[model samples]
Target: MADPLSPFRSSLLPVGVRELAPHANPVTAILMGRGGSLRLHLHGARVEGDMLLIRPGVVHGVVLPTRGADIIYLNGLDFPSDAPLAEALEGKLAQLAGGALEGGRDAVDELRACLAASASATLPSVADVVRAIYDDPMRRMPQGELALRLGLERTKALRCFKAVTGQGFREFKLWSAVQYAAAQMKEGALVRTAAMDAGFADTAHLSRVFRRVFGLTPSAAIAGLSVN
Candidate 1:
């Protein structure tokens, strides 16, 4: 059987309307309201729009509409310029919201195509780190150990990761684990089982991290969630 979590790298999920507190995103995300404009809360400012593009590590919040929202997550190292990327994704998401697109998976595939078209070349070392984390998020690899494996000083490795991915290595690892846990839950795993599978200490630990990063408890977010 195919791995159900394979599509998580660049996937789409449909979520019900809910307000999210300010939190840092671990990957690039595009959010579109289903029936109306969603409100975005930024630093000392707020904006209302039908769609919003959030880059990795950006701290932001959202007030979704009554009809809920469609969120697309892109977990790639190459990201195009924000304006053009947002414009293209907005059109695709609009089609999805209007039922013109076949489904969330199809929409995600189209979005990935768009991303690929504009993706720039990535450094090998950076790609290596990304691959390692995604390949086994449960592994407890310390920063120093990773740096040694990469044949660089610990501080340089940290800088390289932050510069390439726009987030610290530890932050990326935690986020990857969280995403893995979410995928497990989508496959009908219990929270406790998923937490352990994702390297979380326990259910409470997973809950706290989930709420901190996503502004929703695991149970709440996993209910009726569709993972591509």
Candidate 2:
């Protein structure tokens, strides 16, 4: 078998796994299928019928329906985190849950059509670029070394990234780092430890970014959610 694990760009599949496993990424996945059971461990979640929302860095095992299911996996980069369009997609999922079982065949066809249209589009969305950079931040991975690897001029590469993502390259880069680091902190990683582990200058640096993005210091946010 050809690795059954076929990996492709965000545009390539109805289902697949990401490399690096659990790199702190500001990405998400939307899975719509039937009769499949999935075990996911990560932040951010919501589900409906055969649909599932996946947070970045989550480890999971999915059991496809014995009868087989048509799954559509949408990554955050291609779909905004919380936006009107994404909300509309969520609405469709809700519709699927409410009496759309009878239309499973139609729904699957529709999803495949949408995927085809999305693949042929000329301009990528802002969400796509943001998710792309976030998916690989160290500038070490293939996606990270985009400009160098693709042999594109630095300026051109940045232009393409920004045009599609609606964010400055640097901004998305830092934000992606912050998101991953924050997730670790939430998992009870020590302040300084999480910060350093996340490639920050130190805990203080991480604290500042955390406050800026989430409107609360990392310590305060974690404290607010503490069980004890």
Candidate 3:
């Protein structure tokens, strides 16, 4: 049996005209040859950059330059729409655009091809994978295998993911699970089922992490759930 992957897709849009408007789709992008500024309302955090990453549900617009531009966009689904992933992609995009990143266009092409091929696959962040085991009380992921997938020694992978995500990979995975659990609870999932489906070891385990992150136990949060 194959390892279950998350659902996502990627597409490239040509840079024709620069216009200001909210992103209609959830996208992560690499803007190249951009001679103008891009403005993004990522959760109301005003972010300006030559390479903009518009995480899903983020509102953004761009100011065009008199000269033409070249752009690339990489979108994913398995990761959360947050600052960590956005920032990392932004840095990578900048390096690619400025022709300073290692492997040059070949590297960029390879990464793009990788994403395109895996559009139907679930590719978790290096951070999220680690978290699924360590920080998540419910799902205890095996570190050795995950490290191999990330192409790093187990210890090094652990360290690198932490430095980049601002949380050890395990921590992010658990938080991600917690967020999933919360959403499920809000949708009226029974505690046990919600815990299991969210990849937690058990309802008790889910409760513990939920409390740690939100300062409220899973049950308490469930009580406050309002279906709008």
lDDT of each: 0.68, 0.45, 0.50
Q: Which residue window of length 10 is worst by lDDT in model 3?
A: 1-10
Stretches of candidate 2 off by over 4 Å are 1-145
- C-alpha RMSD between model 3 and the true structure: 13.6
| Count of steric clashes across candidates, in order | 0, 2, 7
CA shift at 197, candidate 3, in angstroms?
1.3
TM-score list, all predictions: 0.75, 0.45, 0.40
Candidate numbers sorted by TM-score from highest down: 1, 2, 3
The prediction achieving the highest lDDT against the true structure is 1
lDDT of 2 at 106: 49
As a TM-score, model 1 comes out at 0.75
Which digits, one per residue and each the tens of the lDDT, describe model 2 over residues 1-228? 111121222321222221112222234444444444433333443232345444433343343333322223322234434432122234654454222233354453344334332433323343344445556544422334656643567778777765554345676567667666766765788888777766788788888776554435666555543422
Backbone clashes in model 3, listed as residue pairs: 6-122, 130-170, 131-169, 131-170, 133-141, 138-200, 138-201
Model 2 C-alpha lDDT versus the unseen true structure: 0.45
Candidate 3: tens digits of C-alpha lDDT, residues 105-218: 455554544334233323366534534443444565667866786788989877765554445556656655666666667678888988898788878888776554443466
Candidate 1: list runs displaced more than 4 Å: 1-8, 76-119, 224-228
Question: What lDDT does model 1 reach?
Answer: 0.68
- Rank by lDDT, descending? 1, 3, 2
Instruction: In candidate 1, list every pair of residues with a backbone clash.
Output: none
| Candidate 1 residue lDDT tens string, 129-208 | 67788888789678887787668899998887777665678887888898888778867899999999999999999999
